[model samples]
Target: MDLPHFSILISDKQYRKLNRNIWSEKPVEAELQIEDKTFDVDLLYRGNHVREFSKKSYHCIFPEITAGIKEIHYNAEFMDKSLMRNKLSLDFFSSIGVLSPTAKHVLLSINEENQGVYLQLESVDRNFLKRRKLPSGPIYYAENDDANFSLHSPIDEDIKDSFDSGYSRKEGSSRDDKTLQELIYKINTLKKTEFERAILDYINIDKYLRWLAGVVCTQNFDGFIHNYALYRNSFTGLFEMIPWDYDATWGQDINGEEMEFDYIPIEGYNTLTARLLDVPTFRKQYAKIFEEILTYHFNKQNLYEKINVMHNTLRPHVLRDPYVAKFIDDFDREPGIILKFIDDRHHYLRNHLQDLR
Candidate 1:
């Protein structure tokens, strides 16, 4: 009736049901179902494979090709180039120990008016979770699901324990001081492991947390821990930190009243695993990365410059283009509506490290 909006058509790829890894299934390519037409599409994996191509329960019917898309390279009217630049700029800067990712070159397939930019990549190897294991006993406690702190209305600790512990026949150790100590040990062990040694790309996750501090106090950004985490390679169990989703990042007027704020940390230099950093190790390693950033694409000055450039670049054109005008109008009018969270998101990134100097 209403043009059917956007949808997705999956290629016959035999991917693992649990995780979205490239498995041996003699897979075909994916197609995009926009309205009634289907267009050929390529797969772009970001952060972890968990959400890659995973059908969202709500939007599973009329699937949008852009749904759950983290990073991609394309020549779409105004997409890829802009979005990719934002992502990769942060990413590249991140690799250099900046609180972002480094920019990988864009591979373009251009002709006249349509130049397709595909293949956005960098040398930062992916990593997976560490120290994950089968539950030994009851895991959650009655208090773990505090109403004041719960975000997703996590099932009560008893129910969670029951399901996790095969109907609560046994129990997992409590997160006592000893348990916390064990977690600390396990985290440290992984940090110095041969697996981690290989990824000595100088990941200062602490820096990102530090950046979040500004987001909290100044930007009032409601950044959360669960929103960001460390990634790891499945085979090797190495940890690579990433700050993926930021839809609910920018906060509005609040007296810092959210209990979740208390439960989940939004500041302080730390690890993706919520580990407090070794002060000396953290500073030395981070400084090395910062210097490396200076030696390369890590440009703090360039970040602010880029933001100012975008405001100017998009302003004149958006004035003439109805689509762009609407995009901005909707963002301002509803304030964090339409594209949902991108406006507040851009605000945070655009103004994140401005006070660094």
Candidate 2:
């Protein structure tokens, strides 16, 4: 079970430039070596607080990498002992018919030093849409708490001066900004009846509900308000969600601490979800989706099998990495811990689903 290896070669000056400003999004010129072949790339440190970790994540842009991959991420998975949470979460989303980035565990080396096992994630950009043969459209990353689809700032509760406060337009035109702004405005201002009818014009209700179900089942507390991408489907003319950055999931908090299975509510948090569930039809739809997911996707047997496979796959590599070597015992126990959480969370959701009904 040899994982793919990626080696990065960057000039010391460029490397120093990246370290000089760890928070900077600016990328430094570098060369990537994969399978004895080399390609030019731009590299930079990624993640917010994870940047401070001893094992940092990275973002890379390849002017001409693979056919549809212009960029990719090498996540350190520093806060996740299993090192498979992101991959598992995203795979679940895709399996349930929600668009999500593909990910794989690979070994990374920088300056000829082993950086250990890294989860390589596909970037959510136009290239992502193209690769899937989906209709091209605007894509916006829910950058922060401000992306809660509220008229007021989630931080201080002040009216947002900018309509696009929490979103970064990943691929689209100025018109896309206006479109999202109008959607947000309507979500906050429209009368309940009007909102119930008009929201369908702005978002794909079924897809959104499925995405919500994925987040709820996975229990990504930060997902409702952030850590997702909203793609405006050109053909459908409605916004659909794509999940991102799910290391803190499956009964684990962002700090790799155990989280109670009931920590995140079944309906999830954030204004958009609240508003959507306010409608009876949408609530019923979501409840149905939850039932389906719980029965088929989030069950102990289904998830336990997946977790065991991932755990076994990483067993060979876990001790090889110095950063995670000390935690090998914890890693080995993660499958059971996660399985217990799933069992508890499944019961909790089944009981709670009736409340939604």
Candidate 3:
């Protein structure tokens, strides 16, 4: 079947205005036609550096059009030559039982001009929790690059000040970050032995191990520090990690630079991860998780098959994308690099799982 289509309509004046200041948060009123239904949506150009690119990413919010879903993100996938990095990485995370946003490729047109294929990502919000049958709790978006849950003195004051600890609450009515602050305090000050005993009380340890395994397997160095969502499960009363913005996965850095797949430590990133690895039990669990991922999800054959399917599905659309052609020299060759990376990563992990301790 052909991919889904999204037709966006905006006045010339509004389009020019939006084009003038593409980075502005001021959303312009636009009409979106999707799946034979027309809905009024507020469209705003989103992303930081990608906004400056030739093709822009957009965030669309359907206030009254959709009751359950409030918003969706259209990623330009500018830096990712494969264009399937984000989608594939999210799928991997979901396969391993970690909560992540659903993503799919869709052809997008603006003002009747084809803007090429975009990855449409489901917004992770209250509705996301509802759809997944997960408890609704406080959702925090990692806003900055310094989301490393480190042990900084005056942690409570920093949380009160909203310092660049990289977290911003997107839901719940609590004006103060007492819950997060307490978690950080425990992570930083609790004695090593005591913290090991009490860590699972504050966060979902098993789910986190899976998340860490996913990051390591995909080599998403940026994920551990930023581009993720942390939400507290009201039922479990423990915070869980959600993967986000994975365009730099599969052995490529965010800038499309080739990365060493074996360089990423099994311990992964952030203070919480380091502390977890400090415990022998956590390390053993992490090794076991890696073994399971390699045996099932992160193997070369499985990943290569997924890559072939995505590449085949997107080839025609990518060839029609003038914007992609402007940046990538040979779109056809991009998938080969990803395939090689997957094979190499699987080989490295399979041989190095013992070194994780």
Q: TM-score of predicted model 1?
A: 0.36
Task: Report lDDT per candidate.
Answer: 0.31, 0.91, 0.84
lDDT of 3 by residue, 236-303 (tens): 89888999999998878978888886768666878889899889999999899889888988877777
Model 2 regions lying over 4 Å from their true place: none
RMSD of 1: 13.4
| lDDT value, candidate 2, whole model | 0.91
Question: Lowest summed-lDDT stretch of 10 residues in model 3?
Answer: 153-162
- Candidate 3: how large is its RMSD? 2.7
What is the TM-score (0 to 1) of candidate 2? 0.98
Tens digits of per-residue lDDT for model 2, 15-120: 9999999999889999988888888999999999999999999898997747668998999999998898899999999988899999999999988998889999
Clashing pairs in 3: none
Candidate 3: residue 307 Cα off by (Å): 0.9
**TM-score of every model?**
0.36, 0.98, 0.94
Per-residue lDDT of 23 in model 2: 95
Backbone atom clashes (below 3 Å) for every candidate: 19, 0, 0
On lDDT, the leading prediction is: 2
lDDT of each residue in 1-357, candidate 1, tens digit only: 011123334533412321354332222344544445655554333332222322111111112323333223221223211222333334433444423323332223211121222223322112111113312222111122221111222344332212112111112233322332333234434554432443233233445434433333222232332333333223332223334322222232222122222222222322322332234454344444334433343233434454444444444444443323445553233221212233333333334333231
